[model samples]
Target: MSETIHTGGCQCGAVRFKAHGDEFASSICHCRMCQKQTGGYFGAFATFADNKVEWSRGEVSYFVSSNIAKRGFCKDCGTPLTYEWHGDGVSLAIGAFDDPDKVAPNKQLATKSRIQSFDTLHKLKVREDTYGVEQSCVKLQNFQHPDHDTTTWPKE
Candidate 1:
Protein backbone atom coordinates (compact mmCIF):
# COMPACT_ATOMS: atom_id res chain seq x y z
CA MET A 1 0.00 0.00 0.00
CA SER A 2 1.10 3.53 -0.72
CA GLU A 3 1.84 5.80 2.21
CA THR A 4 0.03 9.12 2.53
CA ILE A 5 1.97 12.23 1.58
CA HIS A 6 1.32 15.55 3.33
CA THR A 7 2.84 18.83 2.21
CA GLY A 8 3.23 22.22 3.89
CA GLY A 9 5.44 25.29 4.16
CA CYS A 10 6.08 28.73 5.63
CA GLN A 11 4.25 31.93 4.75
CA CYS A 12 6.79 33.12 2.17
CA GLY A 13 7.29 29.77 0.44
CA ALA A 14 10.99 29.90 1.25
CA VAL A 15 10.75 26.51 2.95
CA ARG A 16 8.60 23.49 2.32
CA PHE A 17 8.24 19.95 3.62
CA LYS A 18 6.54 16.67 2.97
CA ALA A 19 5.56 14.17 5.69
CA HIS A 20 5.11 10.58 4.65
CA GLY A 21 3.04 7.89 6.37
CA ASP A 22 0.59 8.33 9.24
CA GLU A 23 1.16 10.87 11.98
CA PHE A 24 1.85 9.67 15.52
CA ALA A 25 -0.22 12.34 17.24
CA SER A 26 -2.20 15.53 16.75
CA SER A 27 -2.33 17.87 19.74
CA ILE A 28 -2.68 21.42 20.92
CA CYS A 29 -0.05 22.44 23.45
CA HIS A 30 -0.96 25.22 25.85
CA CYS A 31 2.43 25.40 27.53
CA ARG A 32 4.01 28.82 27.92
CA MET A 33 6.81 27.86 25.58
CA CYS A 34 4.35 26.80 22.92
CA GLN A 35 2.40 30.04 23.25
CA LYS A 36 5.59 32.02 22.87
CA GLN A 37 6.67 30.07 19.81
CA THR A 38 3.34 30.43 18.03
CA GLY A 39 2.50 33.88 19.42
CA GLY A 40 -0.92 32.51 20.13
CA TYR A 41 -2.93 30.86 22.86
CA PHE A 42 -1.64 27.43 21.91
CA GLY A 43 0.50 25.56 19.45
CA ALA A 44 -1.26 22.95 17.36
CA PHE A 45 0.97 20.25 15.97
CA ALA A 46 1.03 16.90 14.26
CA THR A 47 3.83 14.60 15.33
CA PHE A 48 5.66 12.32 12.94
CA ALA A 49 8.75 10.19 12.94
CA ASP A 50 11.89 12.13 12.03
CA ASN A 51 12.75 9.97 9.06
CA LYS A 52 9.27 10.37 7.62
CA VAL A 53 9.74 14.07 6.93
CA GLU A 54 11.66 15.58 4.02
CA TRP A 55 12.57 19.20 3.48
CA SER A 56 11.61 19.54 -0.15
CA ARG A 57 12.44 23.22 -0.65
CA GLY A 58 14.72 25.62 1.18
CA GLU A 59 16.36 24.89 4.49
CA VAL A 60 14.88 25.50 7.96
CA SER A 61 16.58 27.47 10.70
CA TYR A 62 16.30 26.31 14.28
CA PHE A 63 16.35 27.87 17.71
CA VAL A 64 17.29 25.80 20.67
CA SER A 65 14.43 26.92 22.86
CA SER A 66 15.41 24.97 25.90
CA ASN A 67 17.79 22.33 27.13
CA ILE A 68 15.46 19.58 26.01
CA ALA A 69 13.94 20.91 22.82
CA LYS A 70 14.38 23.20 19.82
CA ARG A 71 12.03 24.91 17.43
CA GLY A 72 12.36 25.01 13.67
CA PHE A 73 11.21 27.97 11.63
CA CYS A 74 11.69 29.91 8.45
CA LYS A 75 14.33 32.56 8.83
CA ASP A 76 12.87 34.65 6.01
CA CYS A 77 9.29 34.85 7.32
CA GLY A 78 9.57 33.82 10.98
CA THR A 79 6.93 31.15 10.59
CA PRO A 80 6.98 28.43 13.24
CA LEU A 81 7.39 25.02 11.64
CA THR A 82 8.48 22.35 14.03
CA TYR A 83 9.00 21.48 17.68
CA GLU A 84 11.63 18.84 18.24
CA TRP A 85 12.58 17.28 21.53
CA HIS A 86 15.93 15.70 22.11
CA GLY A 87 15.95 12.02 21.15
CA ASP A 88 12.35 12.31 19.97
CA GLY A 89 10.45 12.74 16.71
CA VAL A 90 9.43 16.12 15.30
CA SER A 91 6.08 17.83 15.48
CA LEU A 92 5.04 20.20 12.71
CA ALA A 93 2.78 23.15 13.37
CA ILE A 94 -0.72 22.32 12.25
CA GLY A 95 -1.33 25.76 10.78
CA ALA A 96 1.70 25.36 8.54
CA PHE A 97 0.12 22.44 6.75
CA ASP A 98 -1.41 22.87 3.30
CA ASP A 99 -4.73 21.66 4.64
CA PRO A 100 -4.66 22.42 8.33
CA ASP A 101 -8.11 20.96 8.73
CA LYS A 102 -6.71 17.55 7.92
CA VAL A 103 -4.69 17.48 11.14
CA ALA A 104 -7.20 18.58 13.72
CA PRO A 105 -5.98 18.52 17.29
CA ASN A 106 -7.14 15.36 19.01
CA LYS A 107 -5.85 16.24 22.49
CA GLN A 108 -4.76 19.18 24.59
CA LEU A 109 -1.49 19.28 26.50
CA ALA A 110 -0.45 21.49 29.41
CA THR A 111 -4.05 22.13 30.26
CA LYS A 112 -3.12 24.19 33.29
CA SER A 113 -1.67 26.82 31.01
CA ARG A 114 -4.69 27.06 28.76
CA ILE A 115 -6.02 30.55 28.46
CA GLN A 116 -9.18 31.30 30.43
CA SER A 117 -10.79 33.04 27.47
CA PHE A 118 -10.58 29.86 25.41
CA ASP A 119 -13.52 28.42 27.27
CA THR A 120 -15.86 31.14 26.04
CA LEU A 121 -14.25 31.81 22.68
CA HIS A 122 -17.08 30.16 20.82
CA LYS A 123 -19.57 32.56 22.35
CA LEU A 124 -18.09 35.56 20.55
CA LYS A 125 -20.24 37.04 17.84
CA VAL A 126 -19.21 36.72 14.20
CA ARG A 127 -18.47 39.95 12.31
CA GLU A 128 -19.36 38.99 8.77
CA ASP A 129 -20.68 42.50 8.05
CA THR A 130 -17.13 43.85 7.77
CA TYR A 131 -16.54 42.04 4.50
CA GLY A 132 -18.24 44.74 2.42
CA VAL A 133 -16.33 47.57 4.07
CA GLU A 134 -13.03 45.72 3.82
CA GLN A 135 -13.48 44.91 0.12
CA SER A 136 -14.56 48.43 -0.79
CA CYS A 137 -11.97 50.37 1.18
CA VAL A 138 -8.96 48.09 0.84
CA LYS A 139 -6.98 46.93 -2.18
CA LEU A 140 -5.82 43.62 -0.84
CA GLN A 141 -3.58 41.32 -2.80
CA ASN A 142 -2.58 38.13 -1.06
CA PHE A 143 1.19 37.66 -1.06
CA GLN A 144 0.97 34.49 0.96
CA HIS A 145 2.07 31.23 -0.56
CA PRO A 146 -0.75 29.13 -1.93
CA ASP A 147 -1.79 26.02 0.04
CA HIS A 148 0.06 23.66 -2.27
CA ASP A 149 3.50 23.03 -3.74
CA THR A 150 4.74 25.43 -6.43
CA THR A 151 7.32 24.94 -9.17
CA THR A 152 8.79 28.34 -8.35
CA TRP A 153 7.63 30.97 -5.90
CA PRO A 154 7.20 34.76 -6.28
CA LYS A 155 6.74 34.36 -10.04
CA GLU A 156 10.10 35.63 -11.12
Candidate 2:
Protein backbone atom coordinates (compact mmCIF):
# COMPACT_ATOMS: atom_id res chain seq x y z
CA MET A 1 0.00 0.00 0.00
CA SER A 2 1.04 3.59 -0.55
CA GLU A 3 2.12 5.78 2.35
CA THR A 4 -0.68 7.74 4.00
CA ILE A 5 -1.84 9.44 7.17
CA HIS A 6 -5.17 8.26 8.60
CA THR A 7 -7.14 10.28 11.19
CA GLY A 8 -10.46 9.74 12.98
CA GLY A 9 -12.14 9.30 16.34
CA CYS A 10 -15.27 8.67 18.39
CA GLN A 11 -18.69 9.96 17.34
CA CYS A 12 -18.63 12.74 19.94
CA GLY A 13 -15.10 13.76 18.95
CA ALA A 14 -13.86 13.08 22.45
CA VAL A 15 -11.12 10.78 21.28
CA ARG A 16 -9.17 11.59 18.12
CA PHE A 17 -6.24 9.64 16.68
CA LYS A 18 -3.87 9.62 13.77
CA ALA A 19 -1.83 6.84 12.20
CA HIS A 20 1.21 7.86 10.24
CA GLY A 21 1.77 4.72 8.22
CA ASP A 22 0.01 2.72 5.56
CA GLU A 23 -1.86 -0.34 6.64
CA PHE A 24 0.07 -3.57 6.76
CA ALA A 25 -3.13 -5.57 6.35
CA SER A 26 -6.82 -4.86 6.38
CA SER A 27 -9.38 -7.52 7.25
CA ILE A 28 -12.91 -8.21 8.40
CA CYS A 29 -13.41 -10.34 11.52
CA HIS A 30 -16.54 -12.22 12.54
CA CYS A 31 -15.64 -13.31 16.05
CA ARG A 32 -18.18 -12.81 18.80
CA MET A 33 -15.92 -10.34 20.58
CA CYS A 34 -15.69 -8.27 17.42
CA GLN A 35 -19.44 -8.36 16.94
CA LYS A 36 -20.01 -7.15 20.49
CA GLN A 37 -17.45 -4.38 20.23
CA THR A 38 -18.73 -3.00 16.92
CA GLY A 39 -22.43 -3.78 17.41
CA GLY A 40 -22.37 -4.98 13.83
CA TYR A 41 -22.30 -8.28 11.98
CA PHE A 42 -18.54 -7.98 11.68
CA GLY A 43 -15.66 -5.66 12.46
CA ALA A 44 -13.43 -4.27 9.77
CA PHE A 45 -9.86 -3.26 10.66
CA ALA A 46 -6.58 -2.08 9.29
CA THR A 47 -3.43 -3.37 10.95
CA PHE A 48 -0.64 -0.89 11.53
CA ALA A 49 2.48 -0.52 13.59
CA ASP A 50 1.42 0.42 17.09
CA ASN A 51 4.24 2.93 17.46
CA LYS A 52 3.08 4.84 14.42
CA VAL A 53 -0.28 5.77 15.85
CA GLU A 54 -1.12 8.38 18.50
CA TRP A 55 -4.18 9.68 20.29
CA SER A 56 -4.47 13.36 19.49
CA ARG A 57 -7.37 14.43 21.64
CA GLY A 58 -8.54 12.08 24.38
CA GLU A 59 -7.50 8.69 25.60
CA VAL A 60 -9.33 5.43 25.07
CA SER A 61 -10.22 2.89 27.72
CA TYR A 62 -8.70 -0.52 27.19
CA PHE A 63 -10.63 -3.70 27.82
CA VAL A 64 -8.80 -6.93 28.22
CA SER A 65 -10.81 -9.08 25.86
CA SER A 66 -8.43 -12.00 26.24
CA ASN A 67 -5.10 -12.89 27.78
CA ILE A 68 -3.31 -11.80 24.65
CA ALA A 69 -5.60 -9.15 23.24
CA LYS A 70 -7.22 -5.90 24.28
CA ARG A 71 -9.86 -3.57 22.81
CA GLY A 72 -9.80 0.21 22.97
CA PHE A 73 -12.86 2.41 22.88
CA CYS A 74 -14.11 5.87 23.67
CA LYS A 75 -15.12 6.10 27.32
CA ASP A 76 -17.63 8.88 26.68
CA CYS A 77 -19.57 7.69 23.64
CA GLY A 78 -18.77 3.96 23.68
CA THR A 79 -17.31 4.05 20.18
CA PRO A 80 -15.01 1.14 19.43
CA LEU A 81 -11.55 2.31 18.52
CA THR A 82 -8.81 -0.30 18.33
CA TYR A 83 -8.27 -4.02 18.75
CA GLU A 84 -4.75 -5.06 19.58
CA TRP A 85 -3.29 -8.54 19.69
CA HIS A 86 0.04 -9.37 21.24
CA GLY A 87 1.40 -11.32 18.31
CA ASP A 88 -0.60 -9.72 15.49
CA GLY A 89 0.13 -6.07 16.32
CA VAL A 90 -2.33 -3.15 16.33
CA SER A 91 -5.57 -3.08 14.37
CA LEU A 92 -7.40 0.20 13.89
CA ALA A 93 -11.19 0.26 13.62
CA ILE A 94 -12.02 0.87 9.97
CA GLY A 95 -15.41 2.38 10.74
CA ALA A 96 -13.89 4.87 13.17
CA PHE A 97 -11.62 6.37 10.55
CA ASP A 98 -12.38 9.78 9.00
CA ASP A 99 -12.45 8.51 5.42
CA PRO A 100 -13.88 5.07 5.95
CA ASP A 101 -14.58 4.74 2.24
CA LYS A 102 -10.86 4.53 1.53
CA VAL A 103 -10.18 1.75 4.02
CA ALA A 104 -11.01 -1.52 2.28
CA PRO A 105 -10.81 -4.97 3.83
CA ASN A 106 -8.78 -7.20 1.59
CA LYS A 107 -9.07 -10.28 3.80
CA GLN A 108 -11.43 -11.94 6.29
CA LEU A 109 -10.66 -13.64 9.58
CA ALA A 110 -12.44 -15.76 12.21
CA THR A 111 -15.28 -16.78 9.93
CA LYS A 112 -16.24 -20.17 11.34
CA SER A 113 -19.20 -18.71 13.24
CA ARG A 114 -19.92 -15.81 10.95
CA ILE A 115 -23.38 -14.24 10.93
CA GLN A 116 -25.42 -16.19 8.39
CA SER A 117 -27.29 -13.23 6.97
CA PHE A 118 -24.26 -11.00 6.63
CA ASP A 119 -23.54 -11.93 3.03
CA THR A 120 -27.09 -11.10 1.99
CA LEU A 121 -27.35 -7.95 4.11
CA HIS A 122 -27.09 -5.66 1.11
CA LYS A 123 -30.12 -7.42 -0.43
CA LEU A 124 -32.27 -6.43 2.50
CA LYS A 125 -34.83 -3.71 2.07
CA VAL A 126 -33.83 -0.12 2.74
CA ARG A 127 -36.05 2.91 3.02
CA GLU A 128 -35.72 5.32 0.12
CA ASP A 129 -34.97 8.90 1.11
CA THR A 130 -38.15 10.92 1.25
CA TYR A 131 -38.18 14.61 0.33
CA GLY A 132 -38.61 16.27 3.74
CA VAL A 133 -36.80 13.77 5.94
CA GLU A 134 -33.31 15.19 5.36
CA GLN A 135 -34.50 18.75 5.96
CA SER A 136 -36.29 17.81 9.15
CA CYS A 137 -33.39 15.78 10.56
CA VAL A 138 -30.96 18.60 9.87
CA LYS A 139 -33.10 21.23 11.60
CA LEU A 140 -31.67 20.01 14.90
CA GLN A 141 -27.98 20.54 15.33
CA ASN A 142 -25.69 17.59 14.59
CA PHE A 143 -23.36 17.31 17.55
CA GLN A 144 -21.15 14.74 15.92
CA HIS A 145 -17.84 15.98 14.61
CA PRO A 146 -17.45 16.61 10.91
CA ASP A 147 -15.32 14.21 8.89
CA HIS A 148 -12.25 16.39 9.02
CA ASP A 149 -9.65 17.74 11.44
CA THR A 150 -10.74 20.46 13.84
CA THR A 151 -8.87 22.89 16.10
CA THR A 152 -11.22 22.11 18.99
CA TRP A 153 -14.17 19.72 19.31
CA PRO A 154 -17.58 19.60 20.93
CA LYS A 155 -17.81 23.35 21.38
CA GLU A 156 -19.23 24.37 24.72
Candidate 3:
Protein backbone atom coordinates (compact mmCIF):
# COMPACT_ATOMS: atom_id res chain seq x y z
CA MET A 1 0.00 0.00 0.00
CA SER A 2 1.06 3.57 -0.60
CA GLU A 3 2.29 5.64 2.32
CA THR A 4 0.04 8.19 3.99
CA ILE A 5 1.13 11.77 3.54
CA HIS A 6 0.00 14.49 5.94
CA THR A 7 0.50 18.15 5.11
CA GLY A 8 0.17 21.07 7.50
CA GLY A 9 1.57 24.45 8.40
CA CYS A 10 1.34 27.64 10.44
CA GLN A 11 -1.59 30.00 10.13
CA CYS A 12 0.31 32.51 8.00
CA GLY A 13 1.59 29.87 5.58
CA ALA A 14 5.14 30.86 6.50
CA VAL A 15 5.99 27.38 7.69
CA ARG A 16 4.79 24.30 5.83
CA PHE A 17 5.54 20.62 6.39
CA LYS A 18 4.73 17.22 4.97
CA ALA A 19 4.68 14.20 7.20
CA HIS A 20 5.22 10.87 5.51
CA GLY A 21 3.87 7.52 6.62
CA ASP A 22 0.94 6.83 8.84
CA GLU A 23 0.51 8.83 12.02
CA PHE A 24 1.82 7.07 15.12
CA ALA A 25 -0.99 8.31 17.31
CA SER A 26 -3.25 11.23 18.18
CA SER A 27 -4.15 12.80 21.50
CA ILE A 28 -5.47 15.89 23.22
CA CYS A 29 -3.35 17.32 26.04
CA HIS A 30 -4.79 19.29 28.91
CA CYS A 31 -1.52 20.11 30.61
CA ARG A 32 -0.99 23.65 31.76
CA MET A 33 1.93 24.02 29.40
CA CYS A 34 -0.19 22.88 26.49
CA GLN A 35 -2.99 25.25 27.42
CA LYS A 36 -0.52 28.12 27.56
CA GLN A 37 1.16 27.23 24.29
CA THR A 38 -2.08 26.82 22.37
CA GLY A 39 -3.91 29.54 24.24
CA GLY A 40 -6.80 27.16 24.62
CA TYR A 41 -8.27 24.72 27.08
CA PHE A 42 -6.27 21.88 25.49
CA GLY A 43 -4.02 21.01 22.58
CA ALA A 44 -4.80 18.32 20.05
CA PHE A 45 -1.91 16.70 18.22
CA ALA A 46 -1.02 13.89 15.90
CA THR A 47 2.28 12.12 16.48
CA PHE A 48 4.71 11.22 13.73
CA ALA A 49 8.28 10.04 13.47
CA ASP A 50 10.86 12.80 13.34
CA ASN A 51 12.42 11.49 10.17
CA LYS A 52 9.07 11.46 8.44
CA VAL A 53 8.59 15.22 8.70
CA GLU A 54 9.99 17.62 6.13
CA TRP A 55 9.95 21.38 6.38
CA SER A 56 8.78 22.36 2.92
CA ARG A 57 8.47 26.13 3.21
CA GLY A 58 10.12 27.78 6.21
CA GLU A 59 11.83 26.65 9.38
CA VAL A 60 9.93 26.57 12.65
CA SER A 61 10.97 28.75 15.58
CA TYR A 62 11.14 26.97 18.91
CA PHE A 63 10.84 27.92 22.53
CA VAL A 64 12.42 25.81 25.21
CA SER A 65 9.25 25.36 27.21
CA SER A 66 10.88 23.12 29.76
CA ASN A 67 13.80 20.82 30.40
CA ILE A 68 11.97 17.89 28.88
CA ALA A 69 10.42 19.57 25.86
CA LYS A 70 10.29 22.48 23.45
CA ARG A 71 7.41 24.06 21.54
CA GLY A 72 7.58 24.94 17.86
CA PHE A 73 5.70 27.87 16.33
CA CYS A 74 5.74 30.30 13.48
CA LYS A 75 7.66 33.45 14.24
CA ASP A 76 5.55 35.47 11.82
CA CYS A 77 2.06 34.48 12.98
CA GLY A 78 2.74 32.94 16.37
CA THR A 79 0.91 29.78 15.44
CA PRO A 80 1.66 26.86 17.72
CA LEU A 81 2.82 24.01 15.45
CA THR A 82 4.58 21.27 17.27
CA TYR A 83 5.41 19.80 20.63
CA GLU A 84 8.77 18.10 20.74
CA TRP A 85 9.41 16.14 23.88
CA HIS A 86 12.96 14.92 24.44
CA GLY A 87 13.41 11.39 23.08
CA ASP A 88 9.81 11.39 21.90
CA GLY A 89 8.49 11.84 18.38
CA VAL A 90 7.13 15.16 17.18
CA SER A 91 3.45 15.93 17.65
CA LEU A 92 1.91 18.39 15.20
CA ALA A 93 -1.02 20.47 16.32
CA ILE A 94 -4.25 18.92 15.03
CA GLY A 95 -5.72 22.29 14.09
CA ALA A 96 -2.68 23.06 11.95
CA PHE A 97 -3.25 20.14 9.64
CA ASP A 98 -4.53 20.72 6.15
CA ASP A 99 -7.38 18.35 6.96
CA PRO A 100 -7.67 18.24 10.73
CA ASP A 101 -10.53 15.75 10.60
CA LYS A 102 -8.13 13.14 9.29
CA VAL A 103 -6.40 12.86 12.63
CA ALA A 104 -8.99 12.13 15.28
CA PRO A 105 -7.54 12.21 18.77
CA ASN A 106 -7.98 8.87 20.49
CA LYS A 107 -6.78 9.80 23.95
CA GLN A 108 -6.54 12.61 26.45
CA LEU A 109 -3.47 13.56 28.47
CA ALA A 110 -2.96 15.48 31.69
CA THR A 111 -6.60 15.23 32.63
CA LYS A 112 -5.88 16.65 36.08
CA SER A 113 -5.18 19.99 34.46
CA ARG A 114 -8.32 19.92 32.33
CA ILE A 115 -10.56 22.89 32.82
CA GLN A 116 -13.84 22.05 34.53
CA SER A 117 -15.74 24.10 32.01
CA PHE A 118 -14.38 21.91 29.21
CA ASP A 119 -16.58 19.00 30.24
CA THR A 120 -19.72 21.15 30.15
CA LEU A 121 -18.80 23.01 26.98
CA HIS A 122 -21.01 20.77 24.89
CA LYS A 123 -23.94 21.30 27.18
CA LEU A 124 -23.77 25.07 26.94
CA LYS A 125 -26.38 26.85 24.87
CA VAL A 126 -25.43 27.64 21.30
CA ARG A 127 -26.65 30.66 19.38
CA GLU A 128 -26.04 32.07 15.93
CA ASP A 129 -23.91 35.18 16.01
CA THR A 130 -26.03 36.88 13.34
CA TYR A 131 -29.22 36.55 15.36
CA GLY A 132 -30.26 40.18 15.13
CA VAL A 133 -27.50 41.40 12.82
CA GLU A 134 -27.90 42.07 9.12
CA GLN A 135 -26.08 39.45 7.07
CA SER A 136 -25.40 41.83 4.19
CA CYS A 137 -23.97 44.46 6.52
CA VAL A 138 -21.51 42.00 7.95
CA LYS A 139 -18.72 42.04 5.42
CA LEU A 140 -16.22 39.41 6.51
CA GLN A 141 -12.84 39.03 4.90
CA ASN A 142 -10.64 36.16 5.93
CA PHE A 143 -6.97 37.12 6.09
CA GLN A 144 -5.88 33.82 7.52
CA HIS A 145 -4.10 31.43 5.21
CA PRO A 146 -6.14 28.84 3.38
CA ASP A 147 -6.24 25.26 4.64
CA HIS A 148 -4.31 23.91 1.65
CA ASP A 149 -0.72 24.45 0.51
CA THR A 150 -0.16 27.56 -1.56
CA THR A 151 2.59 28.54 -3.99
CA THR A 152 2.85 31.97 -2.43
CA TRP A 153 1.31 33.72 0.56
CA PRO A 154 -0.32 37.15 1.05
CA LYS A 155 -0.93 37.16 -2.70
CA GLU A 156 2.00 39.37 -3.55
Worst 10 residues of 2 by lDDT: 17-26
lDDT of 3: 0.91
Clashes of each: 0, 0, 0
Query: How do the residues 1-156 of candidate 3 rate in per-residue lDDT, one tens digit apiece?
Result: 899888999988999999888757999999999999999999999998889888989999999999999999999999999999877589999999999888879999999999999999999988857764576647766678888888998778
Top candidate, metric TM-score? 1
| Model 1: how far residue 11 lies from native, Å | 0.4
| TM of each candidate vs. truth | 0.94, 0.90, 0.92
Strongest candidate by lDDT: 1
Off by over 4 Å in 3: 132-138
* 66-110 per-residue lDDT for model 1 (tens digits): 999999999999999999997758899999999888878899999
Better model by TM-score: candidate 2 vs candidate 3? 3
lDDT at position 122, candidate 3: 94
Please report how far candidate 1 places residue 145 from its true position, in Å: 0.7
Give the per-residue Cα lDDT of candidate 2 at 75. Answer: 94
Candidate lDDT scores, in order, read: 0.92, 0.87, 0.91
Which pairs of residues collide in model 1?
Answer: none
* Model 2 per-residue lDDT tens digits across residues 96-144: 8999867789988999969999889999999786989878988988788
